[model samples]
Target chain A: MEPTNERHLLEALASGDRRAAERLVDETYRQVFASLVRLTGGDTEAAADLTQETYRKAWKSLPSFRRRSQLTTWLYRIAYNTFLNSIRRPVLLQPIDEQQAVAIEDPDPDQAAKLQQRDVAERLRRAVIGLPEPLRFTISARFWGELAVEEIARQEQVTGAAIRKRLKLATSRLREALGEDAI
Target chain B: MTQPTDREVKSLLTEVEIPEPPADLAARIKSEIPADLSSGRFEGTDLEVFDAPRRSPSRGWLIAASLVVAVGGGLIALRQMDQFQTPAGALESGVVASEAAASDAVAPESVQYRSPVDQSLDDAELETVLVEEIQLNEPLETRSSMEAKPDDSRLQEKSTPGPDVTSADKVVVDEVTAGQAELDEVSADRDRSDRTRVDQKTVASQDLPSPATRKVERSEPAPSRGPQPKLETPSEQPQPEAPGEQQTRARQRADSTGAFEKRQAAQPPQAPATVESTAVAAPAPVRESARLEDGAADRSFAGARAGSALAGSALADSALAGSVLAGSYQQVRSALSEGRWPAPEAIRRAEIVLGFGFGGPEAESKQESASPADRFTILVDELVEILERRQATESELEHLLRRSRALATELDGQPAVEELVVWIEQIGALVESAEER
Candidate 1:
């Protein structure tokens, strides 16, 4: 994703270079897949298929891409749209209950002490799945995709300030749902 | 109300584990790249697998064009049929007049009379020789002439004008009348055959006398070889119908047959043998009168030939009229050559060739002023000139031949012009037979 390499790849892709398309796919497919898996609530198979589709769409739309943002950002935009389109039903978040919030906040000392009560990672996964779309997407791309805030803003077609405010709101909601003890 | 620090949230979000993507995912996507690019770099699922082949737009257009052509052709044929209808009687008369005109054109000169041959020999020998010659050279004519007596008996029943005959006789008469009507229906077709038979009879009669006289005259002793006597010896008598007696009977028989033939000419042109056989028995006078009728038949036939030739020329001259279709000419030629010429078919063909079809634009422009015979003469003269010029195409010549064929058909059953019909047919046969060569 260096400025020089991206510019060269973008130009080569615009000129219909297959190698550049392959190179772009290779550089971005993993991050896109990982982000989609989390975005799709642990649906790894669907996430993998959507990841391939995203690359294909990117290859076709590459010629029209102006390169105003990073290639990865453009790719993530395609991946997000691709996953959203492929899913048959709405991927809405369920409402959090007060007792579930209390379990994350002050885990019952007995429950916490139980030998094989669900681990912190499992609870965190459940908490992330319950987040709404776009907030879910933003949080996943930032943490799982490891994309910069500014990069996420560019990929999502939003201002950097709006992304930051969304990130703040998403974090507060997750905290309320999971409780301080879980963090 | 303060939000958690970005570092704290980022740290917590990092704890959220995401499952690893399949290792072969990118490899699978790459494998599909060539197929996608091959189909113009299409993205997403292949929809063509689900779709059936669509009908070509051009196929629909071709079907529409064929329908249009079929409908258009049907309309044109219907329109043509409407324009072509005509009453049959006027057409028949016009055709008859044209054929008679043609016969007159063929034999313009009247037959010349010659002095009677010498009468020195045996009557039995002369009759035997003439009969034998007729049987050999003019079998059909001889047959017809021989059959004429029975036919006459049959005709008597039909034309008897009395109810005294039995009911069965009346039925036979009715049948004969019906048959005659049928034959009349194709009068034009019979003319060529009748013409040929008449010509053969004329030749047989004239030539038969020659051999008989030659044999007898050669045997006689010379009387100083000076101018021979017109009279034969008294003991070497011919028939008891000596000069006036036999001549009158022969004349009367020939006259009846000849007049009967002339009347029948408007009917169908029956076989000439019927007429020829009746003349088989008569003495020199009967033979002489047969020769006179033959001469008359020849002149009529010659005129018909001239008419046919004229028709050919007229057709060539009016080739640009487009009024004469090849189909009509083919029908006329078929009728002429097919052994029977229906008067209706002959008239139809004649009008088409002569540009006289009802309401035809060409006929309107080229009014038919000359008599059919004179017009036929003009046509023959024109065709002769064209043939001499060597400027006409085979199609032009064929058109001429077809015109002659149509005229020949028109001339059928016309006993007066039987000779001309024969002549025109000879020309047609000559021209057509040349193709084999």
Candidate 2:
């Protein structure tokens, strides 16, 4: 189903369409969870749990939506919102000084093992989660899910230009985070 | 074809291949939807029902049979006795017994109730005060004598959950949940090992022998399809399609890269401190005003008072919270009505000094110390202060609004002030209308 004209999907999802709801999950879960995992810097387990929870919330909240945006945008919004909700509990990120990063280097004899410890993608994830908010969220919205400027604007209740500007600043900050040469 | 230009590749990232969800996820998601939609009944209330302890099917049949037999017996008895006695007397007595049973059922409703303390004022007095205060948020709250009414420390927790918890609470909670406990002697031996995940995989992936002892492999996936596949090399990351898409795609990659960049090489710690600090605002225009959905705000405000700040009795009755909000909102409105703008510096001083005395985001960081509303007040105060300092004519202020614009640009994300900027500009139009008159 192209979900684009799947008004029935939405209606069914709204009126308790199990398959439509399943389709919604099948379509969006990977993107949503991957985006969240990226935003959260590879906390795979948390991302998985949050992904499931997002679907639950999205299903319950499907009726409340007044067709403000495409269902996909709404689903992404739900994912971000669920992630925010899950981390609301006290046990979240630790302070920089106190949190000792598990040493990246392993004295293991295998070359692959040593290389994986120094994996670039994983290192990049660490940098992303370290950024301050607003910037961090903006970056995630832009890169991970690749949401459009207007979609992000509507999700955040701001203008497209505003999101564009934030996206720009966020990029500059990302360059700074990733290192000048890395960009 | 030669590798596409950075701009070409940047565009493709937008259409980056988002992998399919793990198979079980769709099933899990499908199981969570509810068909019923009437939220008025569910929002703040859960269904309460009496589950009569289950009776066996045999017991049910036995009860039905007994009832039938008793009814037949009663009819027979009535037929025998009614031939001689007055049937009207029996009917009246039966009616009386039913009335007694009915009264027993209704007794709880009439058990007699004491009027609450606030009830003494009645509909007239309370509504009148609420009507007047509806315009002003509250005055008593600002009074020094009131001593900054102790906020229900837990209000943030109670109010929509997000705005309730403190930084310290967040940190402490994280520590409790994520901290490693003492391991057994056999497991402790693994601490000497370079990586731990292999052990978890070994335990979970029982097919692998000595998985815990196996070292992690760290090589990039083969760059077969899509854009650049490696991490540090931004050129390698997939780009979105189209020329105009360059700006957003590059911006997104830059952001993604920035998050992974770390100073010390180790992962950022798991704590509330980091989470709050990194709670990214949405990518949108921000203004220098604290805008909120009134309903959400009102709910949260009342929420702020409950265990967040109120006694159970006061919270049990929403009327009390509404009265408090009414009373305070009126005071703020009245003060504004009286043309009292608290010193512009007061907000900054309150934030800087109080924020330092209390732990804030940090002295230098750009993140807000208070919630968006409090931060917007600061920005609005700045706008007002900038206008005060310029002493420019409306046209001049419009020109001098260069200052407001500059500040707005610097703040970058205050949606309220950004919206107000349009209104402020519209005021320029209003000024021209006045000049025409």
Candidate 3:
């Protein structure tokens, strides 16, 4: 929802409002779970556990929320940290620290194009998760939050140009890491 | 295909399917938050646990006061017991006799090591303390040995035996017993060889075993008497002290015997004399033997103290020789509990100093040490410290950890020392990075 509505929910929960607490969890659980599943590389159980943990941490830290940023961004930061602590090490998306170069050979042009696109998409997902923390956060917020570049910049207290630059750098890393797979 | 343009990557990201959460997810979350604030359980949405209010100075003061009160109360109780002991000595002795009869007495081994009973405490009081300490923290074998003054029927049953010892205890007991047996066998071998040599001298004064005869004997492969894998009855190495009582007893014995004083006194007077003698003349082999003997004695004391430290009794801690057996297992347990490991530097130093790779995989080198228990303890402490630091590339530390774990497991069932095993596994996880290797 809107930043104003989120702020209202935050206020309500902080003031001992049980209905508001339920509403907050209800609205955020799906998004948090979806975000976690992507971050965890589609491990459903880990996604669920991390989701619950994120919410539990969010609920506890709600009272301390000073509304310096959007409530969603605040919750995402908590989710990110919870994820990091649980994983204990950086998540290695590629097998054996070796990225698989896309190998394409097909007689049909259409079939080859389709296969290449599929490979590129898979590589992109892996790259997004594998991106350095700052860029990963920006990409996640932009895609999952569906927030505009300006909104992300505003929330992060950076200029719109910086957000664009981060997005550019992240895409380049993905291309480099994916190689020919980045079709 | 050429590298994908950023547009293609962006387009792909936009189309990427974000899995829909389970339907019950919202319901599950909602259920966690209480329906009403009246219960005061879910009054606030946030967790106060992690963000607990800062400790006020008052709390610190309160803790200090409580400690002081506890110490004072203990002193008062001790004094009162002392007062009562003198007037009711006869009655207390009668009570002690009855109490000993009520429970199965400790094994005869314990009787040999039992300390002089404090005149301040009655039999009942002493029993209460020993019983409480043993029951609370002593190992199973220790409790069994301490409490079970076996009835004649039970003794007879044990004599007839069907694995009277738990499998875990059986391995440890077997190991210690085998070690003793091996030492005895080696001594006997030397004695037999000496006797044959003497007899030969009498028979033929100049007819020594010739170079060919000696060569033949050397060529004959001796049968390997590796640590006897035989699981003997636990009766062979009787349980002496509970783990918790051992430490207390060790401290008491150290105080009584002025062990610390002896250690201090031993060094100073001999130090200047040894330096002067060694500098002026070549140090004799006798001095080396004396040094080795002293080292062995120190190890024996350390082992004994280690055993008693866990048993929580003075009775178990005084066994200078037996402690050597008890100390190895005790140190393992202590190392596990405390997460104590030797420093990385210490391990490296040992390797360099000893001239063999001390921290290498257990199978690689077979450098014999005068004190294997001390070496084992050092290795365990080092491995633990390394794992706790969570750097997986220390392959040497990893090997030591695995070896120690295997040693512990071989001596006991996995479940018997489950806690230590679990902790070790955690260390393994911490050290084993997501590196594909």
Candidate 4:
């Protein structure tokens, strides 16, 4: 959303305008849901719950929104944190390991290539999840959440240089973990 | 197999598949949301209009029940009165009996006649009949007092008995007049006391310092403890110091300790006994002021000690302005985690302080002192450097931890500080786990 329009909507939401909240949900829920889907490794149900949880949190925190970062970036940060907190719970459903499943017979080369891509994506997801503390968050937010380096830095309350450095370190770690050819 | 380049890896990350959200997801979420988003009430904001409490049917039923009981009691009493009034001769006899009972407690039981009609009456009816008889036989003075209004004109009329009035009526009038006089005296005394209290309050208010004067006093720097300067009389001293003069004096006092030490070391030391004797010889007001300054210093020292202790705990130090920024960060994180908004004031304070660093070179130049953002950045960088090296000594880690804790304490346990603390611990844990491996 445009910053001005977002600000106006935020003002309306802060004043308890229901229409503004509905409009916010309409504009952002898809992107938010998609980010959660990637973070949860294709668990659509958990992603949907987390998406709703993010909006609920966003609505509650609307009054304190300072327009420091773009509203979407702010929402993404909330979505990211929600994902982190959910993972901390003991009963969280583990992502299904598709690699170990019985292979289906494929006659076409395109079909086999698609399967290879899915495998690569799954491996990358696992490697990202395995990355420590802030690197995991940083890489996930940048790649999955699709947030800009500046936006992540603003959300993290750090310098742009620090965020870029983190991204570099996270990428190098991913490279090392996946074995360079895995990608 | 060929290794993927950084560009290819980045492209692959971007291409990771995301499932489409369910069609009913948005509708489901919105349905649960209240129509009025303003229901998420904020503290110190005049946005919410709360509805008045509704009256309950239970309270209404209680009132109705009370009315029914009272009306029923009244009807029963009235019925008893009607039975008593059936015969005038019987009523007269009852009043005489009641007067005898009241005036002569030792009246003979044989003299109290219980007729067949009276025997038919229950205990409640008999009691009601006796009460009515006593009210009829009461002295005129008692009845007059009970019926009289507080109006002065009515009391005067009652006091002036008519020519046909008996001696008993005259006695009643005199008693009523005496009672009215006592009430008037008490009301006058109350008025006097009220006026005296108000006057005392006015004087006390006048004696209190003005707001501006109190502000000045609060802003004033602590006095020095070196050799006492010669005291100045009210006439000799300037009436009121200018803002510049106040600032200069404060600055001088702040720098005085270093200057005093330098002077002491350069020159021969004076006898402590002589200095004490000179200080004691000072004027009473000057000595008192010095004593107050000493007390102020002691109190400030004690407060600092208390503040440090408080900062060491989980609770944030609200007195530190830097902590407000930290609080704002927490407010955002907590809002996400706990599903509540941050206070507007916390966000505003964070914005203002952050604007100093993030507002570009112009803002940095405008601010003469180091902004909280700068301090926060510096602390984060230092902590990160130590964590990255993973070769820090125990003492080094402790010192960094203390600095991190102090900053967090200033920010009031901002999640960033908590995150830093977590990172430090995680590094330690990783080292332990590696050793085990």
Query: TM-scores of all models?
Result: 0.31, 0.30, 0.33, 0.34
Return the candidate ranking by lDDT, descending: 4, 3, 1, 2
RMSD of candidate 2 to the truth, in angstroms, is: 47.3
Put down candidate 1 lDDT per residue, A74-111, tens digits, no spaces: 77778876766765334432334788866675545566
Candidate achieving higher DockQ, 2 or 4? 4
RMSD of 1: 26.6
Q: What TM-score does chain A reach in every model?
A: 0.69, 0.72, 0.74, 0.84
Pick the lDDT winner.
4
What is the clash count for each candidate, in the order shown?
A: 29, 54, 27, 2
**Model 3 over residues B50-155: C-alpha lDDT tens digits?**
3448999999999999999999999988875653334224223333343233223322211111112221233354334322222132222232233233333423
Q: Kindly provide the TM-score obtained by chain B of candidate 4 when compared with the true chain B.
A: 0.17
Name the fnat for model 1. Answer: 0.32
- Between candidates 3 and 4, which one is better according to DockQ? 4
Q: Which prediction has more favorable lDDT, 3 or 4?
A: 4
Per-residue C-alpha lDDT of model 2 across residues A14-43, encoded as one tens digit per residue: 655556656766666777888877655566
Q: Per-residue lDDT of B1-437 in model 2, one digit per residue for the tens? A: 23334343234323333444466766665555454532312222111221136779999899999999999999988875652143223323332333334234432111111111111123444444332221111111121111111233322211222232344334433332222121111112222221232233225323322211221211112111112221121122232111112222221111211111111122234311231221112111010001111122223335334332222222223233223322332332222223343333332221121111110111232354453334434444444454334222565545534544443344342222333343234334334444567
Model 1 agreement with the true structure over B57-137: per-residue lDDT tens digits: 999999999999999999987864542232122222333444344334432111111111111112343234322221122
Global Cα lDDT for candidate 3: 0.46
For each candidate, the DockQ is: 0.15, 0.12, 0.19, 0.20
